[model samples]
Target: MQISYLQQWLTTPTYKIHRSQLRFWFSLSLTFSVIYSVLALELAFRGNYLIDSDARQHVFWMQRFLDPALFPNDLITDYHQSVAPSGYAALYWLIAQLGIPPLILNKLLPTLLGVITTSYCFATCLQLLPVPAAGFIASLVLNQTLWMRYDLVSGTPRAFIYPLFLAFLYYLLRRSLLPCLIALALQGLFYPQCVFISSGILVLQLWRWHKGRLCLSGNKQDYLFCVAGLGTAFLVMLPYALQSSEFGAVITAAQAKISPEFLPGGRTPFFHDNFLEFWFYGKRSSLVPRLSRITPLIYTGLFLPFLLWKSSQFPLARQVTPKVQVLIQGIIASLGMFVIAHVLLFQLHHPSRYTMHSLLVLLALAAGITLTVSLQALFNWAKCSPKSYPWKGYLARGTTVFLAIVLIIYPVFTPFPYAKYKQGKEPLLYEFFSQQPKHIMIASLSEEANNIPSFAQRSVLTSEMYTIPYHVEYYNQIRQRTIDLIRAQYSADLTLARNVIETYGADFWLLDRTAFTPEYIRGSNWLMQFSEARAVVTELEQGIIPALSGIMEQCSVLETEYLVVLPTDCILKFAQRKRN
Candidate 1:
């Protein structure tokens, strides 16, 4: 009766099922979507207080999305739009029509992307293995990684593109070319790097298929599908290509600015680093050595051995088929990409943000191989005259369940004290900003400036400065004028201090204590070393130091030394002192 009821319900137009056996899949997908949506809403409501720099930028842009006309005519030209991919901006612009706050949209969109991507993974696995357990396990495994959670919470543009790229791959595997092409083109808009890597894999797959080396069961439709998809992707990229003169210049500049020495490392080869670090290491840490940045290669190494073992388990005929060959080729191509990336690009101090797509692909391949081999090994152990091993069945089942939990729940819950502010400082920052006047000109380190608006509710100029130094080369050619303006405006502390008093006429300065440390302020020496610095610091500095006792005489501390204000003339005097 239950089965009949389920069948009847699935037959209903609102819950239509094209495949009789897929009734449960529809229910499962709907359930997952609901759960993911709820979690996303919770995260958004909780707010990303920990790493609010990127989040705040998204919010600010989302605000621009809400009121497009509010942005200056040179807004796009100012940042050299190439610094960040344009997809998120475009999406925010579209979503703004719905009147949702930037924060809400940021959380909601990524959550939806996550759910859709997970569902697509399940669907793709079903086609390959045609087993419910395999589909479920695949979905669970892919979701278990720290990578997904990091992307989900960071609110970065790559987070939005990652899932879409995966979904496109799934569609391609199923011989759905038109949809694949559409997805491919759209992904280009979000993150071209992802598209580049994904397309490389796809092209390799197709080449294997063409040479009769891959044994796919599909006919002409599959070939047409792939061609159409690739064609569509090209077409979609055409507009951007025409605009490429500007884009190309930016890319060249950014590449030039990246130091060839620092490699951003995280969990690699699966277990070298914990699952948590692999996915959510946040910013590059000094504690994590340069060699550690290449940890992702560890996953690649593990995958190769596992793939060899898995291939040995299959008969030669099965392994030789086009489909299997294509899969093998894909694995190899992905690894090759990773190796090249590690040897060349990874050492450039590029943030995980830049490597996320590659990371996702590499993880997917590694996890897929690991799950396949581990499951096979467990099954063999369970069946091998298990009378010798009393708890073999239980052990196998338990192991499977444990892995499932790791893949599914770990991402959902691991790194305990999830969503809390870093060291509980975010709330203090938030409270401080909440009390500030509007449209204040804040001169501080890039991270603090980017973070203040989200935490405190005040507007800031040049909060994106941190990205600026890295993207200086690109900005020089594409956004030269704006770059010049920012440089001229904030080149010195005196200039910034004076500008704060004159231009925006700001009454307060909210400075992060860490930002004042020599290491943080080293590059902006003019702001730190001027003779009038004592006076500016006196007004802005909250507490007293024995060495700088008279400094506080000229100014009174505000709410805390973390925040202070000075007379407009005093700030101007500081600027003139430096000039003389």
Candidate 2:
């Protein structure tokens, strides 16, 4: 009797809620979303010096909104600012007028985005399965998947993709033309890659498999909606396609194939020796990432089709509306674009981008429906157990209790806020640079260069983080600067160091404590990209000291536990004194 009652209590929320009480489910879904956002915020503001890792590259240049003089003539800043989506940049620019620094805004955006994403996710789930519990389950699973990755917390253009894409799905499912067109336009402005996915979905909706035959939809409305949506997508994306960047053309797949930047262990590695990894799990190449592996409950989505097949066995499965076909259309659309992206390669951006975001939404819906159906089925089985096989009844009751408990408590054990917050460890170094003139440029081969532009609000000649090789002209200049910096750092002749400092107009040099050693050169993957690193390592191994190494004590303006900063003027003076 106690077991039967327990099963009723466990399944009541999903089974008892008819279509009218959906607000109850919506409120519950939103409550959990707020709770998840609260947890992420706690970690986001954990330190005064912390910034999201990707935001270091994407958000740092936005500091110019507050002070136009910052990062003057900086190669790294200009390139990053140029590549930023116009809508994203304009949003930050508008907000900067209200005096909130972009970094602060970046941290706050994730919480707002999470709530918006959750709201859309819940509504989209309800379209497919009206059960309130299913909506809650889907939103809950998506929040877990989102917080597990850096995308949401980064607050870059990619972060907007989730809510905008989910909004597109919800509107598309509702067959609302104007709102859907608006969603399509917003996606193109913020994250253009999704417009292709949205366009693909719009195109795929015109055809249907009816009675085992693939046929075009006879409804004229379908064709009209497709044309309108496609037209919106094209207009929004045309500017990006037709507008030529001064940085030159995007790298071709042929060029990328031979470039070190695309090789294993390189900055943006896409190709891999392992076939399975390259095709199935590589971050840049995979169709679907193993997100379900991390949040195991998502694996339940795989059972959705099976449950629908045996709809007679699960009462709630019958409530699943024909709109569930939208999810199927979404997956098919994603797959279609994924194939086209692979064929076009870099022209479409990463192929994985086409599929991964949409798959997250599709999987969440499927998982929610599947969980609700299974819960209802288990409850029914448990009720019959006492009248029939006693052992079978106990098993059903046990499994029901277990699943409910795991769902409620699983997030407690999973790590929170995988935002990859890069904390500025050397406060004194940042302070020293921050005090310098805005026109000053720092040259460095140290990883610390990646942090300087963000933390100190100063320009760097180049950084590994800023070395995106897409635009050939921009990358050539960046590559040459990197090679020159490497050669100067490890050369025995002071004249070479003097020439590099003058050519780049470098005002300061940042260095790792171990930068002069052969092991440092050999171990640095960024440094190894340049052939100059090998020659430097060879010289260091032969016990030859670099000119900069001999002058560190004389030229250094600031010192940290792991780094040294040298004033360029002091180094130049030393080189002149030696020349005399």
> Which tens-of-lDDT digit does each residue in 1-580 have in candidate 2?
4665654443445446564567766787788778877877888788877898999988999999999999877777888899898889999999999999999999999889999999999888878886677888898888888887778878999999999999998998888989999999999889998888888888878888899999998878778889999899889888887888888888899999999889998989998899987878888898775554346787798888899989999877888988788878888888988999889988888899988778887888899889888887877876665565777677776776687677667777767646688888888988888898889989998888889888999888888999999899999999999988888888888888899889989989898989998889788788887788988888888998998999898778788889988998999998999899
Q: Each candidate: RMSD to true structure?
A: 8.6, 2.2
Q: Give the TM-score of candidate 1.
A: 0.66
Worst 10 residues of 2 by lDDT: 6-15
Give the Cα lDDT of each candidate. Answer: 0.47, 0.85
Error of 2 at 100 (Å): 1.0
Candidate 2 lDDT score relative to the true structure: 0.85
User: In terms of lDDT, which candidate is strongest?
Assistant: 2
